[model samples]
Target: MLFRQFFDAESSTYTYLLASGRGREAVIIDPVKEQAQQYLTAIEQMDLKLVRAIDTHTHADHITALGDLRAATQCVTLMGEFTQAECVSDHVREDDIVDVDGIRLRALYTPGHTNESFSFVLQPERPEAVFTGDVLLIRGTGRTDFQGGDPHRSWDSITNKLFRLPEETIVWPAHDYKGWTASSIAEEKAHNPRLAGKTEAEYVDIMNNLNLPDPKMMDIAVPANLACGRG
Candidate 1:
């Protein structure tokens, strides 16, 4: 399998490129608009066809490259079924399988940061990799103070959905502000300050009191992302 992780310093966002092999169909996840050209270059260099561009949910921090990639490569634009993005070509639900060549990812509706937030778990053969988009971060969790966010729901999603994965499952989050790249289910369960030993109520209280400020680009990014980042 071919995998590449790209970082955008401005938003601390991580974009992922996945393909079974060179010259084959590929998929990109949580792409940033400014990095569209970079993604195109990588695809061209690998001699691969971009078959799909997926966003876990509507983003409030950075514009997505889904629309741009679709325009350039004719790839299908996808989002979770509950997303408000009207321009996506596909709306995936829980358990839905997204495939590109020999690679497959099963959609897991792990809503927390946003109502439509989702995490993609690599299929049966590679159950060890999970793309946790903004829902889980290294040592911390996504703030649930806005965008229809509910602290209780966030706690439930973490303890029930994500925690069910095997201990060794690799966690690749959408954003990481601490210069950390990846983590494991085991590591997070044992060390994540947000979830380690807290009960549901305690976790809810912690999230509710975070008092985090809104993202700097929320005003522009949210509106643009609702249109699939066409702006």
Candidate 2:
């Protein structure tokens, strides 16, 4: 399998490119609009056909590249079924498999950061790697203060769905404020301060009182993402 992780410094967002191999079909997850050209360049260089561009949910931080990639490559644009984004070509639900050549990603409906948020588990060959979107970060979790976010649901999604995976599973989150790149389920379970030993109620209280400011681009990004980042 071929996998490359790309980072957008502006938003601290991470975009992922995955394919079975050179000349095979490929898919991108959580793409940033500003990096669309770069993504296309990489796909062309790899001799891979871009088949799908997926977003875990509507983002509030930056515009998504789904629309741009679709326009350029005619790739299907995918989002969770619960998303309000009307321009997505495919609305995947829990347990749905998103296939591209030899690759298969099983959609897991793990909402928390957003109502439509999902985590995609690469199947068959790479079941140990999960694209967690913004649900679970390296040592922290996404804020659940807006966009139908529920701290309790976030906690459930982590303890019930994500933590259920094997200890060796690799977690790839959507954004990272720190320089960290990837983390394993075991590492997070043991070291993630937010989840390590806290009860559900305690986690809820912590999330509710975070008092963090909204993303700088929320107003623009939200409406634009709903249109598939046309703005």
Candidate 3:
């Protein structure tokens, strides 16, 4: 498979592009509006056709490129079935397979960071990697203080859903701040300070007491994202 990971420094967000190979159909996940042209350039250079753009959930930290990409490429915009982003052209329910030129992504409803959050497993038949959109991070987890976020649900989603993937499965989270690019399921299960060796109750306590401030762009980003970034 051909895979590319892009970073938007402003929001500490990560966008992903995947295709079976050059000139094949491709899909993008969690794209940032400011970086749309960058992605388009890469897609054009690779001779790939952009067919789908997906957001795991409505974002509060950065505007999405979904609408822009669709306008430019005529690709379908997608989100999880529970999302309120009505502008999305399609919604994938749990276990729904998105097949693009032999590259497949199986949607997994692992809501926690936000009630509509989802994680897409790549090559689901063998489970090579998972695009965990903010629910599971490298050595950290998304704060569960708003947007229908719940500490208990986050714990359940990570422990019961994500942890069940193969130990070697690559974890590609939506954002990372510490310069870490990727992690394996085994590494997170063993070393994640918040989840590793901690009881559910303890995990909940930690998340509840985080007292983190809301994202600087939440007020603007949330409303804009609902319109597929055109608001």
Q: What are the RMSDs of all candidates, in order?
A: 0.9, 1.0, 0.5
Q: What is candidate 2's CA lDDT for residue 183?
A: 96
Q: Model 3 TM-score?
A: 0.99
**Which of candidates 1 and 2 is the stronger one according to lDDT?**
2
- Give the Å error, residue 80, model 3: 0.3
Q: What's the residue-level lDDT of 47 in candidate 1? A: 99
- Residue-by-residue lDDT tens digits, candidate 1, 52-115: 9999878899999999999999999999999888889998989899988979999999888998
Q: How many residue pairs clash in each candidate?
A: 0, 0, 0
Question: In model 2, what are the clashing residue pairs, if there are any?
Answer: none
- The candidate that wins on lDDT is 3
**Candidate 3: which pairs clash?**
none
Provide the overall lDDT of each model, using Cα atoms, as 2-decimal numbers.
0.91, 0.94, 0.96
Residue 76 CA error for candidate 2 (Å)?
Answer: 0.4
Those runs of model 1 whose alpha carbons end farther than 4 Å from true positions after fitting are none
Top model by TM-score, which number? 3
Residue 116's lDDT within candidate 1 is 88
TM-scores of the candidates are 0.98, 0.98, 0.99
Residue-level lDDT of model 2, residues 95-146, one tens digit each, is 8999899789999999889988999998835576899999899999999999
